[model samples]
Target: MNRIALAVCALALIVAACAGSREEVVEEFLPSLESTTTTAANGDLPSTTTTRPAEDQQIDELIAGLADQVREIRGLPLALPPLEFVPGDQLEERYQALNGLKSIGSTRINEAYLQALGVLPEGDSAADLVSFCSLPGFFDPESATLVLREGLADLTPYGRRLLFDELAGAATNEAHDWWGTMASLERSGNTEAAVGLWALVQGDAAFHAEQYVAESLDSTDQFAIRLEEIACQQESTSPP
Candidate 1:
């Protein structure tokens, strides 16, 4: 290559190294739902108070942060439209029960998201299977951690952190910012590379993704070769 061309390529690589994209950031950080605090009007001014204990309030704020994260997902680009068209404000209604998190409590929230995500999209909307595939902690492509984004309104920061900890460290890095990068690939019809990321997931099951894999992959040479490669690598890496 010519000098100017080489310099240009070098600069492009440098730029790529310096910049962090949204998905890369998502993969790297488990965001806390930001907390809000109140201050007295003026040092001497008095403030109204509630009967709830200080710890209850603190716990409440922690849960609020998690709810904020769940709400943010609605703003992200979907892998596909929801199983059926849902109005924007009412989207949370699909995975959670009414009255917000009050009814479900802390214990059942994760299971709710898992059950919802594992079910197939049925008939025409079947391709929507990958819609929930990149949820940060819940969909661990490495260890095959289980869970989803919806039904998070009830989860405390501790609960959210537990799920975040379950994520396979290898899957949530610059090289595998699957949500933004892989989702786009899937949208563009690059099914092979997109689903191939699932190979990073350890367990045999992959919620709704299994439907797409089973229905799409026939006894074709290319698909078979790819799966065999995944299996071989997994076995070779298995510890003694």
Candidate 2:
């Protein structure tokens, strides 16, 4: 399948909690939309309950509005920009658009555009991802996993590493970590994500067991061999 199709499936599966039926699920996922606050040391904007700044409050309201609409879409489709657009390119542009649309917080606009873009197959799914995004929980690993699996390219490498590092720190929680997520994805046989996760495991000592690491290394060797074969075939196809 194409990358867009793959991204759609990833988003569908990982967005479960955000789209679950129970009130508890809604409550659990709601925190992802809350505005974040960082101390002066982190060079972040400050926040307070009663004395929150106007901009922060505005962002909060906007997110709340967006979350309400996304809750209505049960399935969201996947769409890609032009193939000419390279990965990590247009990040600033995309961020600006997302931020602006979010700040506007018009549920109608969110529904119309997200559906038009095929980001939401059903009203319900669109709502879920909106909730996921609006909760502003992408900084958290459990939350970040949802966005990552959804194929969003919002965070920088450093930001992504920080989120995953946090998840790594929570190795004790079976709900978190590569192995746990791998097991979940295994049932679905997400080959690309599995491969990517294995690649991640190969580089990180804390993520996998010796047996898993060894197996991954063997797979890496096999992959290199296969890649060579493909490259050779392409070369043969080209003019002499």
Q: Scored by CA lDDT, what does every candidate get?
A: 0.29, 0.30
Candidate 1 lDDT over 109-179, as tens digits, reads 22232233343222322212222112222332322323234323233222333232222222232123544
Backbone clash pairs for candidate 1 read 33-65, 141-201
List ranges where model 2 is wrong by over 4 Å: 1-55, 75-240
Task: Report residue 142 deviation for candidate 2 (angstroms).
Answer: 2.9
Q: Please report the TM-score between candidate 1 and the true structure.
A: 0.23
Top TM-score prediction, candidate number: 1
Per-candidate TM equals 0.23, 0.20
TM-score of 2: 0.20
- Candidate 1 Cα misplacement greater than 4 A, ranges: 1-162, 165-175, 198-240
Query: Please, what are the lDDT tens digits per residue for candidate 2 over residues 185-216?
Result: 44564433433332233223122222222332
Q: Pick the candidate with the highest lDDT.
A: 2
